[model samples]
Target: MGEVTAVAQALPPWVLVVIAAAVGVKYLGQALAEGSEQWARILGPLGRRWRSRAERRTEKEAADLVALQRQVENLSVEVERLTARDKKRGEFEEKLREYLVYDANWHFRAQLAAAGAGTTLPDHMSFAQWEASRP
Candidate 1:
């Protein structure tokens, strides 16, 4: 490769220009014989038509990305709302259970108090004896 470069550098600039022109002409002649298909194939994305097509594809992809992002955001909000509702429901259930326990305790104590009231002893032993003797 070094030897080739040295040989190329030794050549006159005009010789290089002529060689380049010949190559260009050869390709141009081939393109002309092959018609527009050859030109379109060689130009590929460099052509204006291909560029516009690429731009349209990019725009469509961007729009799709935006739509997907919006869907993700909406789903996140929905998840947060559901999580909050679940938390609130749990708190309410806990409070209801506490109230039920308190109500049960109150009712049990009332029953005990009522039973004790019925079995109350008289202040005087004579009164107690008379009450017991009557029944």
Candidate 2:
């Protein structure tokens, strides 16, 4: 009983309070540091996975854009080819019309010569008389 009482009296109240506070603060700091490290460990993989997915999405978008550009270029070439073909077709049709008109004129002239050679009528007959004389 005497030893316990002496020890209790030798320990100052202020010193005990300071020691308790220091221990509490040290434990709290250790707990906070450990918690922060654990949180980082848990979230590290998730952050890396999210970044990977974003990179894949960006690559897909870039590929799509490249494909679209290629398609547009192909379409433009097709349009140019079609325009050239149409222009050529138009020119061919115009030439065909001229050939047809020339052929008709040649046939008419040949028939007129045949009629003039077969008949004694003057070659100066009007179109109406020529039609009337046709058998």
Candidate 3:
């Protein structure tokens, strides 16, 4: 190795470097050039088309999201309105139930009074007393 290095050092460094570069260029330069040419031919137009389509798709998605947001806002407003109406109806229904309870109680008292006043019950007691005693 030392002898080889001594011989190499005896020569001019640029000559050895140039010989190495020429050998590498002979073996690998053609493959590198062909690869670059194929890349330009096959991928250049396809890459442009792909990028344009991607941009258009993103634009469409943005538009759809905006429309959906508007629809959601409208639906939220409608739901709030309907809920308010339902609350009002529920209040009215509660009032109606309260009135019906009061009216039924009054009607039952009136019937009890009429039965007491209009008839003579047996055994010095009313029919209700007799029924109550049996149960």
Candidate 4:
């Protein structure tokens, strides 16, 4: 008893607390060995909690991925539509330029005829007529 007291006095208070905790854990472990009902009862909830959290995280990630895929699909469709509209605008501009050139030539020939020149040219077609004449 005297030696035990001396040893206890030499150790720090924290060391004694650690020893007590270890003894308590050992007793509990002995009471619940592998495959024991008490072991499952004590640790099953912790295992289930961890598994449920993982499942929820996986489900949320899958949902976010699906949403991103849908957004990409929508953007792709919009890009296709805009590209087609841009192509049509280019065609319209080209047609407008052709008509301006034809009209200029027609006016120049008419002026020459009015000034008593001998050469003649075809009459200018209207905008709609010019468009209908081309493919």
Best by lDDT: 4
Q: How accurate is candidate 3 locally (lDDT)?
A: 0.72
Please give, for residues 71-116, the per-residue lDDT of candidate 4 as tens digits. Answer: 9999999999999999999999999899989978879768788667
What is the per-residue lDDT of model 2 for residues 1-135, given as tens digits with 9 covering 90 to 100?
999889878999897799899999656554443445553344466444544555677799999999999999999999999999999999999998899689668767877887888944334544468689999
Comparing 2 with 3 on TM-score, the higher-scoring candidate is 2
Task: Give the candidate number with the greatest TM-score.
Answer: 4
Task: Please give the TM-score that candidate 2 achieves against the real structure.
Answer: 0.52
Q: Which stretches of candidate 3 lie over 4 Å from their true place?
A: 1-44, 116-135
lDDT of 3 by residue, 57-102 (tens): 7799999999999999999999999999999999999998898688
lDDT, residue 95, model 4: 100
**How many clashing residue pairs, candidate 3?**
0
Per-model lDDT: 0.73, 0.73, 0.72, 0.77
List clashing residue pairs in candidate 4: none
Better candidate by lDDT, 2 or 4: 4
Q: Could you give candidate 1's per-residue lDDT for residues 76-100 as a string of tens digits?
A: 9999999999999999999988996
True-structure RMSD, every candidate: 16.9, 22.1, 16.9, 12.7
- Model 1 spans with C-alpha error above 4 angstroms: 1-47, 119-135
- Candidate order, TM-score descending: 4, 2, 1, 3
Can you give the TM-score per candidate against the true fold?
0.50, 0.52, 0.49, 0.53
